[model samples]
Target: MTVLKAADELEEIVARVGPTAARLLTRGEEETMPEIAEALGMTEKAARARPTHYEHLDS
Candidate 1:
């Protein structure tokens, strides 16, 4: 499998998923890495590690 460690790879993902979803929105329980990877043209692991896994830090 290919790794998306490079800036371009990450950028491609961000472009496809939108900045809010890509850089902020977290994946739901039903969502899997493979789904995102395929959409972003990245590897499952890479997509899983994406910053899209967002969480609310404040109450």
Candidate 2:
């Protein structure tokens, strides 16, 4: 993918999940996958995928 396209995708992902992630971090709450999925309005499977995606970005 092009640099611009990759940046845009990263921006979109942050917009979608950044709030929930920040809230969870500040609250210091341990949440289950189902709880996270509910908070994000996503299926559990999709929620599970997010950590892997983040890990990839981290690396």
Candidate 3:
């Protein structure tokens, strides 16, 4: 997915679930990767990479 789409999806997930859950989702553990990917219409790798992707957005 595009960087903007990834950032938007990550922002939505954080808004819905809070930063703690968002952080866990980015870890790609406990099946969170697939779930987050489906929820955000992104790939598992995109979901897994969101936290780091966000870091770059801020810089």
Candidate 4:
């Protein structure tokens, strides 16, 4: 998906889950995406496949 779409999705997730979603996105741990997805109740595929999707969270 495009960065725009990813950002939108990330924004929505953040809206639902609050700052923890952004914190997970910026985390430097191994398997961070999967951890973030699991924390947010999303599928691992949706998180791991598109790292840039959460760029807005970093900003």
Reference-based lDDT, each prediction = 0.56, 0.67, 0.67, 0.62
lDDT of 4 by residue, 1-59 (tens): 69999999986876556545445555674557666778868887766544555444445
**Cα lDDT tens digits for candidate 2, 1-59:** 69999999989798677666644543533457678879999997887767655444432
All-Cα superposition RMSD per candidate: 9.0, 6.0, 7.9, 8.2
Q: Which ten residues in a row have the lowest lDDT in candidate 3?
A: 50-59
Q: Between candidates 3 and 4, name the one with more favorable TM-score.
A: 3
Question: Could you tell me the C-alpha RMSD of candidate 1 in Å?
Answer: 9.0
Please report how far candidate 4 places residue 32 from its true position, in Å.
2.7
TM-scores for every candidate against the unseen true structure: 0.37, 0.48, 0.44, 0.32
Best candidate according to TM-score = 2
Worst 10 residues of 1 by lDDT: 50-59
Q: Kindly provide the TM-score of model 4 when superposed on the true structure, using C-alpha atoms.
A: 0.32
lDDT by residue for model 3 over 1-59, one digit each (tens)? Answer: 69999999988775555645555545657566687789989987887776665544332
Q: What is the C-alpha local distance difference test score of candidate 2?
A: 0.67
Error of 3 at 10 (Å): 12
lDDT of 1 by residue, 2-53 (tens): 5545777876665665645644435362365567678889987777666534
